[model samples]
Target: MIELRGVHKAFGANQVLRGVDLVVPRGESMVVIGGSGTGKSVALKCILGLVHPDAGTILVDGQDVTGTDRESFLARFGMLFQGGALFDSLSVWQNVAFRLQRGAQRRSPVQAREIAVEKLRRVGLKPEVADLYPAELSGGMQKRVGLARAIADDPEIIFFDEPTTGLDPIMAGVINELIREIVVEMGATAMTITHDMTSVRAIADNVAMLHDGVIKWTGPVARMDASGDPYLDQFIHGRAEGPIEAVR
Candidate 1:
């Protein structure tokens, strides 16, 4: 459903993306794995148009993303940022329904709240948590709220950035399972960037490992173990020594 070809980006003296080419098929979950400075997030930003690419093309369902209508194009996507990024002042339900309460896809206040509640429930949150603010919730609850918000619009495509970054292992596992379930149930095309192997195993139908600003390896998740790419082996095994320099 999504494709990037010869994508490149640079910042002043820092060349981030050399050339990134990737494809995420419709209704499948594709997880990207990489080291800290491999430009994984930059690749995502390029696809989202938050950071313009210096060259190459990005297509969503065969339509060039650059030529698409901004509002309508964005309405089809949902994002779960690494930090949850919930508004501090809004109640949980309001945060979840924020997209639905404004712009072209706006809904009635009552309808928005009802949809929010249902999404929260889908993410394993309770109705009682709706009125609470971000400050009132635990990290896990906050992540669930973020997940609830991402799926609130029932978007056809969802992007997850470091989804298990801050939570404890058990909670991270829960989030992983929730992500897997949501993607399958919603039939959404998912692209996730995470270093967590467990999350990759749980949420990905396919995996791509980014190294030196480009895809070093990509295949069905089940084939990862025998891919024979040194970089992929180093990353998946968390090896201290390999083709990838650990000093960086």
Candidate 2:
């Protein structure tokens, strides 16, 4: 459903992406794993058109979207940012129904709130939480709200950026399961960036490792443990001593 070929991006003097290539087939979940500052977030932003790539082509359903009309491109996908990135002042329902209040999809606030409540319920959140502000919720709750908003429009594709980063182990697991379930239930293609192996196991059908600004390995999630690639092995095992250089 999505494809990137020879994608490259650089910021002034620093080169981030170096000839990156990736693909996410329809109804599949692809998880990108990498250490800090490896350009994982940059790659996601390129796909979302938040960051324009200096070189290479990005296609959505076979349409060339590189630096194309962004509004039409973004309307087809949903994004759950690293920190949920919710508005501090908007109520939970308003946050979730944000898209419904814009463009041709605009609806009355009451109608939008109803859809938001239903989406929240789908993510296992209660109706009472819909009236609360983002500040009133816990980290886990905020993440759930973000998720509800992502799926509220029934987007064809979803992007999850470090979905489990700040949550406790149990809460992270819950979020992972929810992601897996929603992807399957909605038949939506998903691309997630996370370093958590637990998240990979629960959410990924295929896994790709990013290193030195490009994909070093890509394969089934089950093959990750036995792939025998030094980089993949080092990352999966979480060893300080391996092919990967330790961050000083």
Output the number of the lDDT-best candidate.
1
Q: Looking at model 2, which ten-residue stretch has the lowest summed lDDT?
A: 66-75
Per-residue accuracy of model 2 over 171-216 as CA lDDT, tens digit each: 9999999999999999999999999999999999999999988999
True-vs-predicted CA distance for residue 173, candidate 1, Å:
0.5
TM-score of each predicted structure versus truth:
0.98, 0.97
lDDT of 1 at 197: 95
Error of 1 at 72 (Å): 0.2
Write down the RMSD of all candidates, one decimal each: 0.8, 1.0
Q: Candidate 1, residues 1-248: lDDT per residue as tens digits?
A: 99999999999988889889999999999999999878989999888989999999999999999999988999999999888999999999999999999997799999999999999999998899999999999999999999999999999999999999989999999999999999999999999999999999999999999988789999999999999999999999999999999998
lDDT of each: 0.95, 0.93
Q: Would you list the clashing residue pairs of candidate 1?
A: none
List candidate 1 segments past 4 Å from native: none
Residue 159 lDDT in candidate 1: 97
Scored against the true structure, residue 247 in model 1 reaches a CA lDDT of 94
Task: State, as a TM-score between 0 and 1, how close model 1 is to the true structure.
Answer: 0.98
Residue 45 Cα positional deviation in candidate 1, in Å, after optimal superposition: 1.1
On TM-score, the leading prediction is 1
